[model samples]
Target: MRSLTGFRITAQRSGVAIAGTAAALLLLTSCAGSGEPAQEAGAAVAEDCTPLHEFTTIEPGVLTVAAMNAAPKFHALSDSGPFTGIDATLIPEFAAENCLEVKFKPMTGAAAQLDLREGKSDMFGGLILKTPERAEVFAQTEGSILYETLGITSAKDAAYDTVDSLQGKRVGTLSGSYYVEPLKAAYGANNVEEYQSDANAFEDLKAGRIDAVAWQSIQGFNFTDRDDDYVTKILDDDQKYPELTVLLENNWPHTKGNSAMTAAIDDYYERAKADGTVARVLEENEIGEEAAELYVNGR
Candidate 1:
């Protein structure tokens, strides 16, 4: 027992020294000072911070944009096999800025909103109006992308002068559109004849089955260009149609989270508005003389 205490104390001191050395090594490694170059350590920290930059930037996959393909505003070509409109022009620019590829999907009738809600498309690019009900499912931009004036198209010799004047007349409108409510309220639901498409509605107006057709002024004017049988006049005169904007939902059914996508889109829209790309697209699509004014005034 004479030397047992000395041996035990020496072994305990050796064990404590080894533990402290291991702890020091760990601290040095954590501080990135384990004999590694400073630049390499900085790079490792940067790689960890910017995780999004690691993905392939080649295409960023496809962003499907839904359109009604209604001509002057939107149209899907059979030969081209896709849609084109003011939205078509602007979307590519927006996509380019965000490093994305775009694919256009043409839809008709009442399926436009359904396609977006069902996650069939990434965005809806036509002249969709903003409403409290619509906001429940979609996120809208702060300012309008463009302004469209709703008007009535009638036969050149028709006698209607005001919305009230068409109280008993048959008015053609595209079914399930925001315009339906106002037209039904103005002319009574019984007097309003609903059409599946604007093309058919314009056709009926030309055929004299309907006394007037309600449509966007610029779009209706463009339609009249294609067919000379009708004359277009502003319906409300004060240009009260809802402001058209690009639409994207808060959450798409296909994605688990859309915060990053929405942020990218918002940044793209802001930059486009600042650099005049948006205005150029509107002009190239022949929106109207009043488009720039309307956009600036937030109407």
Candidate 2:
């Protein structure tokens, strides 16, 4: 992998059945680039990163992050190789701030968990929600990013208003997405259709093959509001659904009890929020600020 801007990445992408996509592919991880070690959490920007580096890491001076593919905004492979979206892009800066180098190991969420458990990954994030089960295994941070699940249907169709309303309807989302199992438990597995990509799911919804599309709120905004025919329904604050808080917010989860790592990440988040880094990064990535900010910054 080449370092386009002081960061390099490696991805492990599961094959997708998109048009012209390979039926199967395996990825080899790689890394590049070097920089001055960054300062520690809450330390002055110019402070040395030695104290922060004193703590143990999966690889000395190298922060290997585990991430999953959630393209256009999370993870993607380019000519330069694998890299992260807004948050991922911040890794280099995060690394620099902590006096470390950033490398990535891509995998499915399940695989990421395994990697974390076995010590292959020093940390993990990118649309990763903080769940009770995960909380048991990792040092999950409080909301690093916020979102509520949103539902979509063809412009030709009407929005679904309640969980009961979806009882018998056909719903679609990315296969194995966090939304699937819970939706299945509530709507019945038979009624939930999982696809390899959100693009495919939305296509099916548009083709009338599925009744509605369940997605992260920002994703829903991207798929529906962008099109004249499609409309969206945002669940009210009081409602509990697949997109309830626990499942919607992203957390910076690293090794359990690794307060140094936690403080480092949280400090990055706070700076990102204060300096408008998070907001600017979101817009630069073409994500709608209003939709994404609904849950960010306590708005």
Candidate 3:
């Protein structure tokens, strides 16, 4: 008998012609499903025929993953080393399955996309939106690994509730962020102000240069906590933005080669959903309350 990954099979003949014929016959037999019951057919086999673990045989390599330094999601502490949010925990499991290694990089909010575009990073794992325009530059994975709700924040004395309310007021946001589009659509392109980074946007917002700032709920809350003068408020019903997706860079200016990565990402989401790991991560982080519930309930 011959052994491959601990599986012992009769070594009938070790010739190219014999191997080819055996391969064809095995394919044909597999396609022709036996009429016997599955349990009965399995019981008839003398060898222990259970399939080997699917993940162990994949090729091993290092993959660079990028993320913006956002707390409770993806961030680095000078003393604590690099860490991830829900998406981060899944990376090790995925890598173990694929026999790959991961190297994490923290890019500024503005430079994250540029890093991927220049081939400096293999993927970004965070709340990235998949826009048609961006698809030209990168490939997007199927389904959002997490959901983010947008919120508007202002001084406690500021009065605003709806998207129309922000019409003439200056709104601050980070450059190259998904919030830019929604803010532009709601408050006219000119009314939306872009900053180089989230810290800069928060600074401008605190300086009274901008009437309000629009960002993810977690970030909005974090900003408010960091500054005493700022007040965080969830955007009104009319101002809420639709859910967006995270995208990964593909082999662009070449042929489309990120299909495999995209497929793997989709499979990751499916497994995460089935096992409730997604919900657990959200709940542990104390963000995305609604999404966590939906994921936990198997929605």
Candidate 4:
């Protein structure tokens, strides 16, 4: 099997289908020196756009982004329309704050980090978890949002909120997620099923192939909202299962060693929070107030 890191995919545009394999062609978009916000094809650029902070980007006045195509809750990459979702809007706001326009290149989660390391993109977007390993490789800003891993089960089944409840139960999770192994260890390896995507896991869960799907709380909310007879429960953190139970902070990953860029992003975060921009954005996306608090200060 080819490593996911080796596969290259292009940004989705009107009349384009997103590739799901390594056979996808790589297409790099060129930025104009216009210094205005980058938009989908045919979107007019304004006459004036000034940076609120002084920071360098990959291209002059363009914030090249390696966006996660799969994560619609945080940022949705559309085929023929403007970007939407929390990070989608937040990233543009940050770009404008730095006096740059956005130029997005949609790809998988792993590809985003690879692009950052190769200097192909200024930053990557999604509900990116903050980790020591990632921080060592990229300059990360303050927490843009909170991520609380939860257990999502069918309403027909008993709600699960404790580790004991999950023992021996068939639980599904994303293949490469941070909580995957921890969940397997806690619930027993034989009892855990890893799917390539959350959508697949949700499919299995609804079909009774699995007892529950363990993923971020936001996903659970989205699933239950779309599918009746489904419910979510916050798992209790017994300290031993903190990775699965703790509220984690998600942030943006920029090119490594870019202190000015990092500082500017951090500044943007502070200003966004203080002025209620972050709260307003989260609420507009239907994110819960508790999750919003995590963005303020993870509990």
Candidate 5:
């Protein structure tokens, strides 16, 4: 058995439904065509991709991408088709490069991974990252972004700063996130609480239900930047935590043994990296180099 290479991810927006009266069919069709291109956040002009010409995909000449709906990164509006974010926006480049049409499907985390395994989708990506075990089952590309854990607390309450300080209080983080175990280890299992989404965790924090919210640095920054009621803080300076960093890799996965598909993904990643596409996308999304440095270098 291979890595299964699939696990849970946090939600950005609720449901796969469009929020308004978007032209459902037209949007889907337009999203698949060449007329609507991916966001021009990357510097590279992707060259023609021909690997899929002979590759085995669920849909003939169409690249089926299984993704979750998340705002500012990927969105499948109520009926507006797929728009916004890295995965949704990158459809055109995949289509143009591979000489194929693109189709984006919204499904639960388990279902999405199942789609890739069953060949329902050519690939899938999101808050998903790669592990050594997963690599055995699915070939992966380099991570486009980095991830590190941090803590957030209410602005009115400055009682908590580090994990040790929250020993007697409740700490919140997204359920099924990689940070869960590490946080539990740092703050004690009895003190940890998990939420369905970032919004939920922050809601608890602002309401003073929890002493602090333990989460990835980006997540901590993302919400605090939006509402001044909360504040962001780091724990890398603490001596107790030495290896408190990881990169949240968003790699596309194909079925096991699909060497051609794997090669295509890796090749594109190299080109995309060299062209500054990765950096540009992160910048546009407000994931600055400074934040990434904090994760990698722990500065």
Candidate 6:
């Protein structure tokens, strides 16, 4: 709900996992007993961080994060007891920079959001789209990545160029997603099939159970990056369906009223963008350049 324009943030990173491996578990436990603030990047001494300590988290010197079980390139709970994907990497870096130990809790759907609202968790780790409805309930950080919804269809079929064009066609989307209702409104409710996961939606599309799949552009690319049978493209925006047409931004969600945490995380992103860390992380995860370059223009 707050704005973070022109903020400055700088923090140090101890050698940690970039590839989402067992090293993340080491990063989490290695600093648990230190109880001291993490040093700034390349600093000779730690800055006075009494203010950071003044703000309360679910636990002292620990940031408990609520994470979804699986979301492909965004986040997944690895068997190694560490999270894998973009948010997984970024969140640990944020914790390390802020001199806090990190703890992850597996949750999904409304329960995940409720965890943040009730102070059961300090933040949500997966990529959360920035929207007014969410902002009204949570203290969302600045735009970290650009998000665009794409329409996926078989290569042999014509693409749905606009939202309304899917009116009579069967379209599948992730259940509980922000686009679900708008998609159902465009493609008649009876024509829309909601799946619990993207894998299920795409499988139904491939088997002709649905005519198309509406999903995140990045995640869709992960599905169709090498397959020639499917193709993905952004659907043109229609005034009647602005939620589907307008470009969206993604950010980390924290409990509302935690202004200090919001400012700290925002500062972290601003510095990460300026130093090329953000783009580097996106690239490592195979996200497109469009998203890597989006932090320059805030929504």
Q: Estimate each model's TM-score.
A: 0.67, 0.71, 0.66, 0.77, 0.68, 0.75
User: How many residue pairs clash in all the candidates, one count each?
Assistant: 2, 6, 1, 1, 8, 0
Candidate 6, poorest ten consecutive residues by summed lDDT? 1-10
Model 3 ranges with Cα > 4 A deviation: 1-60, 78-80, 225-229, 236-256, 288-291, 294-299
lDDT of each: 0.49, 0.56, 0.50, 0.61, 0.53, 0.59
Q: Which candidate would rank higher by lDDT, 2 or 6?
A: 6
Error of 6 at 19 (Å): 21
Error of 6 at 204 (Å): 2.0
Q: Which 10-residue window of candidate 5 scores lowest in summed lDDT?
A: 1-10
Give the lDDT of residue 36 in candidate 5.
34
Candidate 2, lDDT over the whole model:
0.56
Error of 6 at 73 (Å): 4.0
Output the TM-score of candidate 6: 0.75
Compared with the true structure, what per-residue lDDT tens digits does model 2 show for residues 23-91? Answer: 111121222112222222333223334433235687676677766545434554532234546556656
Worst 10 residues of 3 by lDDT: 18-27
- Model 5, position 209, has a per-residue lDDT of 84
> Could you tell me the lDDT of residue 286 within candidate 6?
56
List the lowest-lDDT window of 10 residues for candidate 1: 18-27
lDDT of 3 by residue, 77-150 (tens): 32123344544455544543443444555555556677677776666544565556666877776565654445
Across 158-264, the per-residue lDDT of candidate 1 in tens digits comes to 73546666778888877756677778776789988987666677767777799988755544555654444656665334233222111111111112145465555
Identify the runs in model 5 with alpha carbons over 4 angstroms from their true place.
1-54, 79-82, 107-120, 142-156, 159-161, 237-243, 246-248, 286-289, 292-299
Over 4 Å off, model 2: 1-54, 78-84, 151-156, 175-177, 225-227, 238-247
Looking at model 1, the pairs that clash are 70-74, 71-74
Between candidates 3 and 4, the TM-score winner: 4
Flag regions of model 4 displaced more than 4 Å: 1-48, 70-72, 75-82, 142-144, 147-156, 188-190, 294-299
